[model samples]
Target: MNVAPNNHKTGKEADTASVANYRVDNFTRLVTYSPRFLLMLLILPVLSGLVSVLLPAFGWAPALEQTRFGVQGFMALWQTPGLTQMIGLSVTSGFISTLLAFLMTLMILAAFFNSVWLNRIERLFSPILVIPHAAAAIAVGFLIAPSGMFSRLISPWLSNWELAPQGILPHDAYGISIILGLTLKEMPFLLLMALGVLAQPELGKKLRQQHKVALNLGYYPMTAFFKVVLPNLYPLLRLPLFAILAYASASVEIPLILGPNTPPTLAVAIVQWFNDVDLNLRIKASAGAVLQLVLTAGLLVLWLAGEKLVKVLCNNSITNGRRKYHDKVWQTATIGLTIVILGFVLLALIGLFLWSVAGYWRFPATLPEQFVLLHFQNSFMQMSTPLFNTLTIGFITTLFAITLTLLCLESEQLTTKAISPFTHLIIYLPLIVPSIAFLFGLVWLQQLLNNQTAFLNVAFTHLLFVLPYTFLSLSSSYRRLDPRFANVAASLGATPSKIFFQVKLPQLFAPILIAVALGLAVSFGQYLPTLLAGGGRIATITTEAVTLANGASRRTSAVYAMIQMVLPLIGFALAWILPKYWFKGAKA
Candidate 1:
């Protein structure tokens, strides 16, 4: 009787274990087949940061002893002296910069959409994508400053001057310098985005053929491009356009270096208030942050309105059936202007290189009279710690971000449900939102959580910022991957894990490296996150460059800026070369 009862209990326990194992396997399948949980995890930080800003905008920062909610912060913010001028500067620079970038992008596509010029333009512009916005701004500043290389080269030859002509080139009063600086930096990004849009297989060949058909129907090249191709293109470009608008409106480092002092751009002013020694100004800064969001939204609305106006204008041109306008002239004009822009960028970077080694260099001389390694040696020693910290943070954040993105994308592949538009918005939220509005809140959250590891804290913050870009960079190749490769592996009885590691990952190695390089660039370019999360206890090449720009030591600043350029270049080079070598060896 005892043996019979024991056997019965053992059978019952075995059944229970079997059920538990089934449940566990089912849960694993559910997670692997959906990205719902991952989406929530990614969106949580963005939501938290918004809430943190919203409360303080109403004067409710309890830590600062202002526990009450009111509109005092907003009142103070609007009442700031020269507030209207500041808003105008922000709007004008943002608008003009975005408009120019958009028009230039359209013209390039119109004129050179499928030609050799287009191919060469893309190849040349690819490297510009890796140049950080801050570095580009610094480079432009060096090139255009009153005492800068351009003036130095022209001096005594064309113009007789022993001293730099002040109030002439950079940091001018009307913010033209800022506008120009922003346009140069933004053009490459918009062009890159346009290339991606135009390069889509469905759009690529079909659109070119459509343009040719329209041209054959008595439409000019620019006219045909507008009537035949651009309507399809604009819809795709809307999000990236909004991103540029937001960035130009809330830009900090660029405006700081190139904007006016008497009334700096609104973003710069807000940063100043946030960093003010008086704790009460933090509320003002918060109010300003909210205003920045509103300002960016307003600019986007205006752009949308302009789109409607352009539609009407283009409709008139397209239907009027007049075919004799000089499309070649427009093409030539755009090409010349683009060449000028590229020339400026090249000269600017070369100016930085020249300045870094310059010693006892006086005004009115094109080349340095004396060159030395002193700046490099000194910068090397001073930046060693920060350099290591930057590398460590970049490595940690990129590794985790790439892994997370891969998992989410892989889940999408496994599921029938496609990643939704709302999910794309989640990925773009960090880029759309100004860093000032939420980064401080992030700093507060970090302190509250007692996350004292500065490196980890900063790396995590960077991961949030970097993940969206990494996903964008990699998602295209990932989603478009040929399913037949996996199908073949499965036919050979390969498990899902083995197929992923052995087949998909190897095939995607190039895009993976490219995504990593993009992430590394994005992290290196971060300023506000590093400043707030690291609590000024950490420094990187970017922060050092921006800080050094405030001082008059051009040599020191150049050294830091050049160093910032090098790390990303190495990443880009590897991304470019590795795949070729790997495939070459595979054939061998």
Candidate 2:
């Protein structure tokens, strides 16, 4: 009887082991395949979108009844008036703005590394990072236009003029305004990306140690950062740098607001062509879209060349090992410039708020005549539907984006394999490719399949952009979560799913929520995706704000812009507040 009992116990144990092994194998398979699925999901749409544009560029659009393939679209695009100027403006504004933003970012990092100044900068610039491009453009317009707040602040005092200046301040001939606006918006992004990378505990410690070594070796702080830190740092930042370059090259909203009208940047011109009344312009627009892709790619190539040249030129200076290369003067200048740039952003925001509440404000006045809620009161009703749509889209997009990001991160843990570089590129494709190029084609595909699902369609499109940011925001923290927690959970007989939900997730709650806020911010800022994918069937705060911004109603535009700006701020606030309360109960 004892022998029988022992055999039965052994059989039961074997069965249990078999079941556990099966589960483990299954989970591993799922995890291993998840990245592949993500890559397919991201790549296929981009390819289809590209193909959709390509067909029309070659004159093959059945919707327009031109089914034959030819180069007429390209010919038409070539012959467009002031085409050369458009190209030149796009190249100049894109390249110069990106270069300026990048240089400013490097300067700030070199000047303030491992100091309280760096922390102060991080705190200040974080909020600016959330402001939508369209809203920022509007803010910049209010701040810098001839009749803008800055001009008024200086009028009849510094310059002795009672009236607004007549020269082109915003829509200047050389596209300087576009460059300034883009730089204001982009520099914060590069700063944040660099900061995030440096915030990694291990990497930051190593970098700090290296800096100390450089200091001991008689290198100036800035020069040490350049010689020791930047060489290592720049490679890590290559992807984000490329993203900034691509965005600066082909962004539509800022250029639309501030670029020259005679020959706007090729991006704005392409948008105009697409929206033109004549259907023939659609084909030409497709061709222009292709050209936009080419132009952006060319800009990237130029930037790469510049990188090589800079490396060659700096090689000697780097090796010379000077103790002090005017470090204090350089630091003060960079710090001053950083404050000025951030101050411009802050003043721009204040300008938006001031305009929203101003009543009968006149020129040369520092403050408004009266701060009234009339604009808000009058515009509240108009804002209702768009606000609702914005919230809905942002929530839906954020939820799915967070879910997908968490899943991808969890899968990495389960499989013990990091995503490959190719997969990384796929994730970044949306950011690096000019949205104007493929989004139109994607919209066309959506129309053919079923445009009636505008809400879902728009959310999905937002996901394309939002997911990348979401993943990037959350991945570092997710990966950095101590593995021992999971190991302990596993030892305690928790299933992978259970451990993921109970242990890993609770620990990652703060970062996940921050990622949620960032995803929402990204969704709220989307203009082309929402506009193109929604097919004008659905309106969001972004669309409404952009529309008002383009119109003559600055006050109304400010109201919409304020609402747009506030939504993301609200998301961030909740992200901050919820974590404190959420864990308080758990801790108790």
Candidate 3:
């Protein structure tokens, strides 16, 4: 009996031990994998936005007011007379801009599908994508302002009547100018992202094959693109579309320049509240920010729902007899509108260039009365320090982002099972959420950490923005790389580090360079974060450009805008050139 009892106890204990060991092994794997997992979890920078917006919305901000908390702030926000109109402006502008951009992108893609003009058009679109949004807005403002280039060009020739030299175009009570500006800035981004999506090898091959088959069946290219390619492309394009929608809804600077004073967009209103001399208004600003967030989030959800509906419709149509309609009207409209968009972009650039050199070129002058480099000369002298600071920050941020992205890619590759969606989410957190909302909380944190170095903090803040894009650009390339070479090299007794440096790095040098360049561009374009994190001590080209743009001197603003455009162009050029030099003999 004693032996039986002992054996039973031992068996039970062995089973328990086995269970405990399995738990321990699982915990060990989780703990070991937690860093990369945590990286993914960082996607909810939305939480930062909630914290920043909610506290202030509830009147809990110690910096602004001593009000403990109450419904008063929320009520105050609602009761504000122009609040409804402001919300209307934001929603309308955002939706319209995104809608126009989406249609234009679709049209452009449809029109140029597998044509000779496709390459040329894509090449032309590249520079437009690289131009910073704020700079583009400023350029558009210059081009359309009464005293701007358009007025100057047509003033003398038409009816011998001078351009009014005072009224704003499409910038009346409706905020249409804001919509136009945002569309102009966002369309190229959509196109570029579309290009990236279209470049996927499998998708491209499939699309090409489908196009050939459709063409052989006597289908028009546009019809084939719409019927065959759009369904595949839309899914890939969804994220960028969401990004545009969010941006349009929360945009501040563009509306500030072009939106009506009687009732600005929600973003502008929030900015005003934050900047209000009255401390009590900060609560209202917080409330406004919360409202803006809710509105944008709601739109995003709606967009996703619509996408699902469209997918279902498309899939169902495949099973049913869906008549293929070649809408030449749509094709004509798309081609015409795209030409106009391209024209405006070119006009904006030309207008900016002219303004940079214009001495006395005011309204009614077809050409500058006197062309001199004085504005550039003066602006460059004043902006030299800020330019240097921008470059330094951009370089450091890009370097860190590239290194982090490489590590992330390596981690993903080494570990299987999708490496956690959270990692990718975290990388993209900064893009979806509004910067201003989070920067407020970040400011509070900065104040708490009073002893920390400003430069380090600013760089860290920039990393939060740059890392996602760098990782995204590099991830696809990294995953596509063949492991056979590495395996062979390892079999030949090459060290891991040696193989990585000699083989992997050489193979990925071009993409890595492009990723770094993109990171540099993103960092350079940052405005809100730099201002908030630097404690107003560090000046960057973006900060200066915004400040100068707010000033009365169009000439000075033009100079800053040019610099903003030029820096990224230089980075892109370097990104292009370095790989060619470094991997001259290597087969792609």
Candidate 4:
């Protein structure tokens, strides 16, 4: 070896050694420079939250007196009466709302697939999609309650005489009102998702061409839609469907406002148990959380099965139908449903605005008896701190989520092999799993770290929910980007950073803005993460609305709900306006 190492080596051998060294350095840099590795850095806080929350769920939390594992807490959960009923309510509401939303979405798409009204309907849907679930529930609660504005409007004429407000709709024993409220809130979401799918110019053009061919063969538009187009659209629409299922199943705030109190939905019940001042009851809450998780998983499987069945049936009918029914019944039905949904949305907002300004709005009164601005004034004065806190959290979370997502997209683009499926699994797990389970884990980690920095922890927790959606929205556009420009720029001696800034960034500006707006809306709507991670120290508009809703105080809740609804709409408008003006010099 010593004899060979003397400077007697050939030039060709030296060249081979240099090449091998360069290859090693390149491999090391590639591994170290991955976006997934960068993503891990962003997720450190969430990992801590998950661990913290899990400790308490097990019997490991010292905050509770459970020094050892036992079946005592789970036994208490089983012994609780009406627990079965609560779980049933959660399942029923979740299934029904998702089913109705899907049906309504399909009908609307069948009617307005490429019609003149499509754009108008899409514009209307944007604001509705931004309305927080809690705000929508509270607003619906105010409008449909026994002494609500609807009752007041017809009580004198239809019910006759006016002094007795006996038949009330809010808190109905059957949960019909809850189902209706959830449907109203969820339908717009489904519609938005459908619109996004339909907006794909290539897909739209292909579907339209197919429709024309079918029409020339004497088939009706609805028939063509049900037969030829819907199958293509269903796959694109599944993500939103899963989102609706998850929200409906584990939602706490909406159920608190509209679900039956005697045996509230499982989520509300779990929250009650967790908040029980007794340490032992927390174990029962943990058990209930586990039960909720099981129920959600079961429902998801059922949904997938049902979707498959529907697709098969629809495909069969498309091949078998012999008659041309040009009745446009679907169009009429869709228009009617849209009108009713919009009417309810308008009535809710109007009622909230009126209640916020009323000094006295007693039952059986169509309008407030006396008008005063004091309620609005008071709400604003008290809400300043929470509003600031929410804005700060939302801005930071949105920025962080967008940045992380962009990096991930860049990395995936650079690599040829598919990234880990677990990346998506981890991101979407938060969306489908009960928030309580994840929040519990986060709390345990917080305790272990003994880091009392609540705001940072809370924002990081919100990012867990927000990041998945932001990435999903951005990934499509990012993948669709043409790589030729980057290659050409590189050949021209441009650096990677400069190419991204000068070429890729400009093209993605619109989708990025939309992603940010969507992220802001998600952050604004968070309830459980904010409450649990903030330790009640951070109150967003959602938290304020939920607290007032618990008391069923129409005036204050209405005011807070209005603010919650408005802030997101503003974000959406910016999403639309900023891109249009910046890119095309016109309004979207």
Higher-lDDT candidate among 2 and 4?
2
- The alpha-carbon lDDT assigned to residue 132 of candidate 2 equals 94
Give the C-alpha lDDT of model 3: 0.76
Q: Pull out the clashing pairs in model 4.
A: 49-442, 50-441, 52-441, 52-444, 52-445, 53-440, 53-441, 53-442, 53-444, 54-441
TM-score of 1: 0.93
What tens digits encode model 2's per-residue C-alpha lDDT throughout 1-588?
445444445778989978978887776676667777778768877888988999999999888899999999999999999999998898899889988999999999999987888989888999988999989999999998988988887888898878888857788879999999999889989999999999889998999999999989888899899999999899889899899988888888888877788988888888788777898898999999999999999988888898899999999887885777899999999979987987788889999999999998888788888999998998997778888888888889889878878888888888777888888889999999888888878877887899689888898899899989999999899989999988998999888877888998899889988999999999999988888788777898888887888765889899988988888999899989999999899889
Using lDDT as the measure, which candidate wins?
A: 2
Which stretches of candidate 3 lie above 4 Å from their native place?
A: 1-41, 44-46, 62-67, 163-166, 308-329, 417-422, 451-453, 585-588
Off by over 4 Å in 4: 1-67, 311-315, 323-327, 416-426, 482-484, 584-588
- How do all models score by TM-score? 0.93, 0.96, 0.87, 0.88
The clash count for each model shown is 0, 0, 3, 10
- Local distance difference test, candidate 4: 0.78
Candidate 2 CA-lDDT value: 0.88
Which candidate, 2 or 3, would have the higher TM-score against the true structure? 2
lDDT of 4 by residue, 345-449 (tens): 888888878887888766677888899877788889999988998899999999988877876777676565555756656656666666765576666566557
For all candidates in order, the CA lDDT equals 0.83, 0.88, 0.76, 0.78
**Model 2 alpha-carbon drift over 4 Å, by segment:** 1-30
CA RMSD, predictions in order:
4.8, 2.3, 8.2, 6.2
Q: Candidate 1's residue-wise lDDT over 1-588, tens digit each?
A: 455444445778989867766765664475474466557656777678778888888988877888888999999998999999889999999989988988888888788865788879888877777877777778888988888888888897787878888646677778898898888888888888888777777777888899889878888778788777888788988888888888898888888877887799898998888878897898898899888878888888898898899888777776677875788889789889878878888899999899899998888889989999899998898888889888888888888788878877877776656688998877777777777777767676676677678877788789888888888888888877899999999899765656677989999999999999999998998887887788788898888888998775889988888888888999999999999999999999
